[model samples]
Target: MLGLMQDWPLRLHRLIDHAARHHGARPIVSRSVEGPVHRTDYAAIHRRSLALAQRLAREGVKPGDRVATMAWNTWRHIEAWYGITGAGAIYHTLNPRLFPDQIAWILNHAESRLMFCDLSFLKLLEGLAPKLPHILRFIVLTGPETMPETSLPGAVDYESWLAEADGDFEWVAGEENAAAGLCYTSGTTGEPKGVLYSHRSNVIHALACNAPDMLGLSATDRVMPVVPMFHANGWCLPFIAPLSGASLVLPGPKLDGESLQSLMQAEGVTFTAAVPTVWLGLLQYLEASSAPLSTLKRVVIGGSACPRALTAAFERRGVHVVHAWGMTETSPIGTICGVKPEVAGRDAEGTLDLQETQGFPPFTVDMRIVGDDGAEKPWDGTTFGNLQVRGPTVTRGYFKAERDALTPDGWFETGDVATIDPAGYMHITDRTKDVIKSGGEWISSIELENLAMGHPDVAEAAVVAARHPKWDERPLLVVVPKAGREVSRDSLLAHLAPQVAKWWLPDDVVVVAEIPHTATGKILKTKLREQFAGYFGVP
Candidate 1:
């Protein structure tokens, strides 16, 4: 006999409706570009979203049509997101940090019909407007008082456009499998490929993320997602927070340590998520300032591994740091290194060590490590292999690209070399492309990078494989030293000597002013590879 559970169709609009009905008064706060904090509630957001939906429909946005948004994390951006999706249109978030050519290419590739952006990006939009053939209209997310007169005509103020719209509208109903949003991967190699998220996938991902074991979001929690809305929907916190009726604090265009710290204190934020660079700034700011994060309870660090020092600092301050691992393909949450019940009583050092791992898979995710011969490896934490995952949230295939990336059995190759312990904990050793092979032995650049970051003088580090005639390839360490701190190559190399295998140590160390990074805050090793391609051995 079938179970008596309700057969509910998961959809994005349903989540918004639930929040509006049950948690209408919950606050969704944002720090705007004008240096003022703007506060709204779920009811207002829902009403504005409906108005936005009506405006989008009037702008010729048909079902499944792509509506591109190039804006920061703000209440209006969130409204635009739900509004576009609620009207049966696809919401495509354009990363502003990408090159103009890449942005133009994505806009054309996605066939976006309507473009909504913040007033801050007027110059950027004007520069690339000539190349975006698919974008028929431009709507600035600002009032008429601040709308600038630019060479690119036909721009409409967001408030004025929505004023002519009506909020008394019904959400367009469609199949749960209908495409809801599209996000392009950071194109390190070829042109960026798109990951189309279905309404069902998004809703499920949001629900899974809200569970007590995962992010454990609630209406009582105040969240500040320092991760930009352009990056994997700020790791899906925007949707999950509103759905859970949590108070959201969005830092728009101002991610500096002072600004973020002030907002966190002012809003009494309990949870926040961002990449390592942003946290580094906050940690440094906290170290110098006497301000206490009185309400902060959890910090989610992803996009890169969190430094051990940073994790320890937060833990000492009574804030839990959950190191997460995922990509643009996995709805950006594969593993969250939360404290398991079994290890809850472990000593501070031991617990911190476990927290440093990539963590175990969440409820909806399944992970496995495959050897070169395609055989699954034992979970001993010593046998490193290529990581593969299959889940409800993982992308099945790239939009309009070859399906070869997906396995016959439906797993997506994560391209990360990792180890899974018997306890089901996964630790990423390195990316397949980033793994350095010397004399037929694999060297994990991630391990080296982590070790380098542990040095007090080193602020940032990236390890890239350099060509070597003797042993196929070798590693070159690029480091960004702490401000006003001096570090020599020998001293930094010595710091790692006792921490790693002898051969795994970097072959050469190069100090640089700064390490290049992708738009999503990941170190751009692809560019580093090109910069030092000719240096086969010690230069």
Candidate 2:
């Protein structure tokens, strides 16, 4: 016997409606791409989103149609999301950092009918316009004055476009599972594949991430999403913040240490989320300037492994660091490193160790590990295997792909090797292709990279396998030292020798002025492997 509940559908428009009614006056601040700040609230956003939705309908957007957005984490972009999705159209966000060829490929592949772009990216769009014939119109995310002259067809200013329509509009209703947004991977290995997000999936993901053990966000908190909207929907904070009625301070395109520091203090930001690299820069800046994290209370670190040293630095200053883990396929929020009640009796070190691992899976997600012979592995805390997951928010297949990328038993292979403790805490060891194999022993490059980062002189480190005559593959260390500081290979090796297993020691250490990174700030190990493929081969 099933109890009946409200037949109301879970959609994106309701989040803004609830926020506007309850938290109408809460501040939503943004440093506009035009070199000024813009401020609005839930009520204004709700009214403007309705106007924008009407405009979208007038522009011929229909249900299931794809409308792309190439803008930063600003007020306008946030409005576009609710407006586009509310009008029964999928909002496709394009990452301008990608190669022009890649941009054209995705635009054509998605068949985006209309694109909302920032003024900063007009030149890129102009150059890419001729190739993306699928895109019917381009709306620059600017006013008439700031709008640059372009050769594209039907180009118009954002303000003028929205002004053409009145704010009298209601959202178009549909099934809960209708596609509302489209995000693609960074295309590190091959052509980027799209992950289509649904209204139900995204709404459920936002609720799960808001649980006490997860983000723990409340209406009283102020959030700063340093992660770009192009990166997995800014880890879904754009949705989570509104649902929780939290004030937001978007940092526009300036994510440097100093710029972020100013926003954190000026806005009284209680919580923020960003990649490990961003926090590293902030910590370095704070150390150099001797400034305290005045108003910032907690930080959620993801995109890559959060190094121990980085967390340790923040812990010293009373700022809590939450190591988050997710992928584009998981609606970008799978696990958050929150301390469990079972860990209460453990010593401080024991608690810290558990907190360092990627925390337990949220209630909505399911996780398991499998071995090469197609068997589930034990959650013994030490047994590492291929990680697989399935949930309402996880993608079952890629967009437009001919086949599903899942195991026969219906689990999506995460391509990551990990271990889960008896208490259900998961720890990522390495990617399947990144784990170094030497003399029948498996070595985790991620572990070594973290260890190397502990060195005072080592600013960034990446561990890749190099061919060796004796051992089939040996670890090679690529180091990027802190600016103006000299790094010595021998000293770094000595520093790491006692920390890790002797066999895991790097074969050699070489310094590079800078390291290559993907658009999402992950170390591009693929490029590094190709560049250093013959380090051992060389005489």
Candidate 3:
């Protein structure tokens, strides 16, 4: 028999409601694309969101309709998320960094009726207008003064549209399992697939990610998410900030190192999250200028592995670095590396080593690794296998796929190969397809790349499997040297000699001016493999 208790459903709108009711004056700051920083409070955000919902309803935006947005992280985009969801519609974020054809295809695939875009993408949208016939309207996210003349149909300024409503309407209520948001993968493996998120899943993910051992956020902190809103819902920071009553800062379209450092310092931001590449730029700028990040207390790095040198650099400056791991399919927050009680006694060096791992999951998510025979591997820190995960927030299937993307036993196969230590820290070795094979043994390219990044002269590093005749396959190191620094092959190899097994060493080193990357700032190894496929004279 089920226990008797309150049956109130947990919905996404309640997060905004909680912030508006209790933390009304908490600031929601943003750098506007029009050339200045703008500030608004939760109370104003709540009121404007209600106005937006009313406007949507009046325009015949029915429940379950897909509303598209192609804007940066700003106050307007944040309001659109809640407003669209409150009107019982799904918000689909279109990544501007994606190819124009892909963006058009995604818009048509999702059947988005109305779109809200920034002024910078106006020309882009105009160029793709011929390909996107299903889009009925284009609402520019700006005021009358900054709005530009556009050729798209049914175009209007956001301020004019939002001013039509007085926020007199209440949020439309529905089941917790209704679709709320849509995010597509980077399509590295194949065609981009959409991961539909439900209201219950989004709310649950925010709750789990806000725990003490997870992000550990509090109301008194100022938070910034350098990650884009169009990417995995800005890594869920939009929701986490409001749910915890933290002041949110959006960097707008200016993500350069100097701009970011200036914003963080001016706002007194204490917590922030972004990929490793962003931090590398900031560190470079700080080294050149000798600037201090006096207000930053912690930074959570993801999107790619955090180099050990990068982590140590931040720690040396008295800022904590957290290595998190997740994908669009996992609501983008499967694990966060917060220190646990059992490993608290370690010294500084040991702690940094442990922090390099992806860390364990919260109770909401489950993780495991299995070998070729479908047997669970031991948590010995050295035995690596195919990583698998399953949880309430994890996607059971793609948005419109014919079949579920799960194994016969119902676990989602993450493309990564990893090992779980005895203390439950999970460390990723390599992707299943990217792992190199020498003779019959497996070698992790990620391991070699991470070691290469520690070199003082190396600015960036990548490893790919180059075909070898004698060994079947071997690892090749590709590096981009720092400006005006001479990084020779012998010196890098000598630096890595003592720390790793001799067999795991790269067969050769190749220097390049730059490496190609995906739209999400990840190394595009497919291109690297093709470029150096015959480096060893293998047929």
Query: What would you estimate as the lDDT of candidate 1?
Result: 0.88
Best by TM-score: 3
List the candidates ranked by lDDT, beginning with the highest: 3, 2, 1
Q: Taking the tens digit of each residue's C-alpha lDDT, what string does model 1 give over 1-539?
A: 99999877677888778888999998889998766889998899999999999888887788999999999899999999899999999999999999999999999999998889997888999999999877888989888988879765468989999999879788888889999999999898899989999999888888887777789899899899899989986799988987888888998989989889889999899999999999888878887787788889999999987778778878889999999999989998999886667667888889877987888877788999998888899999889999999988998889988654688777899999999888888999888998998999999888788778888888888999898888788888999988888888899889999988888888889999988989888899889998997687534
lDDT values, one for every candidate: 0.88, 0.90, 0.92
Write the residue-wise lDDT of candidate 2 on 1-539 in tens digits.
86698798999998999999999999999999998889999899999999999999998889999999999999999999999999999999888889889889988899999999998898888888889888888898889889878987799999999999998988999999999999989898889999999999999999999999999898999999999999997799999999999999999988889888877888899999999889889888887888657888889999888888888888778788898889999999888888877766767567567766898778789999899887999998999899999999999999999998889999999998999988788999899999898988999999889888888988999999887777888899999999878889899999999988889999899899988998889999998988887788842
Off by over 4 Å in 1: 1-8, 402-404, 536-539
Q: What TM-score against the true fold does each predicted structure earn?
A: 0.97, 0.98, 0.99
RMSD vs true structure, all candidates: 1.7, 1.4, 1.0
Candidate 1, residue 212: lDDT = 77
Q: Pick the candidate with the highest lDDT.
A: 3
- TM-score, prediction 1: 0.97
Off by over 4 Å in 3: none
Summing lDDT over every window of 10 consecutive residues in candidate 2, give the lowest-scoring window. 343-352
Question: Which scores greater on TM-score, model 2 or model 3?
Answer: 3
